[model samples]
Target: MFTIATWNINSIRLRAGLVTRLLTEEAPDILCLQECKSPVDRMPLQLFADMGYRWAVARGQRGYNGVAILSRLPIEDAGDRDHAALGHARHVAARLPGGVVVHNLYVPAGGDTPDRTVNEKFGQKLDFLTDMRDAFRAEPPRRSILVGDLNIAPREDDVWSHRQLLKVVSHTPVEVAHLSDAMQAGDWVDITRQDIPTGPLFSWWSYRNRDWTLSDRGRRLDHIWASRDIAAAGHASRILRPVRGWDQPSDHVPVLASFDLPV
Candidate 1:
């Protein structure tokens, strides 16, 4: 059994303490991070190593678009694919001892506008997801777990006010359609939703909302997905919503799942 968690740390350097806190407390066997915002050399690997996560694979640039996987169990560095040629360190993959591949990604937020014609970032987001679809179609994923701040809510219940957010960037129909295409191409199962199945689940609460609990306006931007071959192994899915309430917390919270891998 392996417990894995994924979170958009916002900035690993700034929130290293939060990582340590989670390591000391929840102690997931593997932790995938997006938006690390720091180079690999600058990551606190030694610190994480001290807390039992001695292995890691990462891709990063200065102050932007980074992803990493830290593991207490032995892990091998799998390739990093810059999907859509975004030229950003948006993805990194790692292989676990049992050959399960784990992908960590930070998809573009697509700016404020929904129209790709008017917004360059929005265009990039669509292209990135299109590339994801093409890549997965070319080489379908097997025994893989993908997690990240994918930046789209995708489902009606994923956002606080689905009707209100239908025009919003994360919940927009176009964005959701693109994300769904990628999922379909890879034949990935939404493990988190599979276990829970229903309800207003969310992993991201905006910083704009003061007293976020009262407003309860949040989105399920972070996700945990498994290739159909291993989908049955995924269980105990949980969103660490209380982590968002921690002091100096990231706007995003952690999403977790445990896997009972076949021997």
Candidate 2:
């Protein structure tokens, strides 16, 4: 029973205590975090180690776009790729003891405008997805799991009001197609959706909403995907929404899954 969790922590240095609480409480064997917003050297690794997460692989930038994987299990740094040539530390991979490669990614949130023509950020987002698809197709993933704040909710049910959000950046048709293409290209299974196949599941809510839970205008922007070969072992998918109510919590909550790795 190997459990892993992913969260868009927003900032690691500021939220180190929150992470510590999660580590001591939920205690997933491994936790992948996104948007660390701290340089690699500055991450609160020692603090996490004190909480029993003694190993980690991370790629980070000064004030934005970073990813890290903290593990109780022994793991090795596998490479970090700067998808879309945006030069952001948005990805990191680690090889677990059983040769299962875990990829932690932070996809770019295309700006408020969905149009690539006017929004360079939006164009970069689309380009990033294309590169991901191409890379996966080039070297198919075997025993792998990819998880992160993908930033796009690819299903109608993934958003609170899909109809209203069709033009919204995260729930737009173009973005959904790109995410689906990437998923199909990698032969990945949506483990979260597979486990809880029917529902309005969400992991992100806007801070704009004063009463986020009451409004419930959320989106399933984060995701956990497993390669088909090891997907059958994936289960126990869940979202830690309550964490959003934590003191100074991130806009995005944690998403978790368990894999029945053979002994």
Candidate 3:
């Protein structure tokens, strides 16, 4: 069995030690990271390699959006696409043994406004999801897993207060619909939701909250998805919420899925 995890580290360089701690503790076979906020060459990759995550593929920029995959297993960079023509370093893919592909992505935050007419970032977010849907429609995925801080919390149960957040950028109906279309296009199964079908689930808590755990006002922004054939092999899905309490932690936590498949 192999386990894979995803986290929006916010800025890898600023919190490299936290990542090392996670590696030492949970030890997922593959870890997908978003918002690395550093150039690929500047990433502290040697430290990861020393911890046994010897293989990796990353797309990074100076100090903004970035996505990377660190692996203990043998893998090759399968390449990436610039969805929505945003020109951000937000997507990366890696091919593992037996033809399995993993995609790490960081979707736009869409700003504070939910209305696309007044908010260009919101429009870009929708366009990104649309482009993803079209791409999957063109060539559907197989034996694939996609993970990242997708930004939107699609379900009512995904947020602490869905009714209040209906007009919020990430929880708005339009964003949810866009996300659903992307999932349907690729026939992706939400591994976490598939395992825990009910209750309020969250992976991100706002840093603005002085006592985030006490307030518990969080959203399930990070996600793990699997193609039809591979979805059945996935189990033991969980969100490491306690990680959010770590010193100088990212607002987001890690989500993991254990697969009963060969490496």
Candidate 4:
């Protein structure tokens, strides 16, 4: 069995120690991290490699919109795409030894306003999803896994209060529709949802909440998706919610999926 995990670290440099703690504990075969907020060269590669994650493919900017896939298993850099013509380092892909491709992405967190007309960031987010849909429609993925902080909470149960967040940037109807279209385009299966389809699941909590667990205001922003061909192999999906309570924690937590496939 192979275990893979996805997390939006928010800032890799600042939380490299936390990542080390996770690697020491969970020890997933592969870990996809988003919002690295550092150049690829500036990442703590030595630290992770020392812990046995010697292979990686990363796309990163100086201080924002970055992603990386770190693996203990052998893998090759499969490159990335500049979705929506946004030159940010928001995507990176890698191929595992047995030909499974893994994509790590950090979707834009639109500004406060839900209206594209009033919020340029919101329009960019929509455009990014549109580009993703078009790309997948043009070349459908097979035997692949996609994970990231997709930003939007597509399901009503994905958030603490869907009604209250309807007009919010991440839970807006337009954003949900766009994200859904992207999913349909690739025929991707939501691994986390498939594992636990009936409950209120979440991977992100607000730092604004003084007592986040007590308030329980969270959203299922991070996601793990697999192509239909290999989706059935996916099992034991879970969100590491307690990680959010870690020291100097990020607003997001790790989401994990285990697959009954060879390395």
Candidate 5:
């Protein structure tokens, strides 16, 4: 069996300790991290190496965007995505052993406003998804798992207050449609959705809320998706919610998925 975990660490430099803790606790065969917010040189490579993992990173401007994949097995041929016109550091993909490819993504978080015409960030977010759709349509990966902070709650049960958040950026119709377009383009299946096809699943909580547990205005911004060929092999998908309460935790929590693979 092989396990893969994905999280938006917010900032690798600031959350190195938490990352170390996660690595020690979960020991996933592969961990795909997004929103690293540090340059490749600044990342604590030696630390993870000491913990018995090899890592590769594709980075953007420091203090802005970055992504990395850490593996107990070997990883190779890492590359970044060109989001057509948006041009953000939003994606990275690496090939692992056994012909499985992993794509780590940090989809653009549209601005608070729902109206794309008034919110340039919202427009950019849509465009980014469009580009992703086009790219996958051109060249789709086989036996792949795509995981990350997709920044969209594409289901009614994915949020605490779906009715209230309908007009919100992440749950807006435009964003949902774009996300669906990307999924359709790649013919990818949401592994988590396939398993837990029902109510109230969330992976993100607001730091501003004093009583996040009580308010529960959370959203499922993070996800794991698999190509149709390998979708049947996926199991034991979970969200590490307890980590959200960790000291100095990120607003986003880790989502984990496991696969049965030949050794």
Candidate 6:
């Protein structure tokens, strides 16, 4: 069996210790991290290498958006999406020894203001989704797993309070529709949704909230999607909530999924 995990570490430099802890505890075959916020050269590659994981490939920006995939097994060709218009560090893909390909993504977070007319960031977010849909329609990967911080809560049950967060940035109708279109274009299946068909499931909590536990205003911004061919093999999917209470936790927690496939 192979396990894959995705976590938005917020900043690899700041969270290196936490990452080391996670690598030792979870021991996933492959770990995809987003929001690394450090250049590849500056990232602690040797640390993960010493922990039995090889730094396969990483796409990063200076003190901002960044992504990396660490693997225990050998990785073949890997690359990032050419979202030239937005030019954001949002995507990366790697091919394993087997036919399986893994995609790591960090979708644009539309600002609090949803009006694209006023918010350029919001417009960029929409355009990014559109580009993704077009790209996936052109070439869809087979036997693949796409995982990351999608930044959009696609379903009503994905948020703690859909009624209250309807106007929120992540759950807005426009963002949801665009995300749905992208999923349809890729013909991707939400593996977690397939397993847990009901109730509010969230992977993100607000650091602004004084009492996040009591307020409980969370959104499911992260996801793991699989191609139809390998969707049935997805099992043991879970969110590591306890990690949120760690010494210095990220607002987002890790989401893990295991498949009965060789690494």
By TM-score, how accurate is candidate 6? 0.97
Per residue, candidate 5 scores C-alpha lDDT tens digits across 1-263 of: 79999999999889999999999999998888888887788888788989988656565558877888888888886677768556566788888767888899988898888777898888788888998899889988588899999999999999888788889889988889999999999999999988888878999999999878888789999999999999999999899988889999999999999988642
> lDDT score of model 2?
0.95
Instruction: Report the C-alpha lDDT of model 6 over 157-196, residue by residue, as the tens digit.
Output: 8998888888889999999999999899999999888888
TM-score of each: 0.99, 0.99, 0.99, 0.99, 0.97, 0.97
Pairwise TM-score winner, candidates 2 and 6: 2
- Candidate 2 TM-score versus the reference: 0.99
lDDT of 4 at 189: 100
Candidate 2 displacement at residue 38 in angstroms? 0.4
List model 2 lDDT by residue over 148-253, tens digit each: 9999999888999988999999989999999999999999999999999998999999999999989999999999999999999999999999999999999999
What's the CA error at residue 50 for candidate 6, in Å? 0.4
lDDT tens digits by residue: candidate 1, 140-167: 9999999999999988899999889999
Clashing pairs in 2: none
Candidate 6 or 3, higher TM-score: 3
Clashes of each: 0, 0, 0, 0, 0, 0
**Cα distance off (Å), candidate 2, residue 10:** 0.6
Displacement of the residue 28 alpha carbon in candidate 6, Å = 0.8
lDDT for model 1, please.
Answer: 0.94
lDDT of 4: 0.94
Q: lDDT for each of the candidates?
A: 0.94, 0.95, 0.95, 0.94, 0.87, 0.88
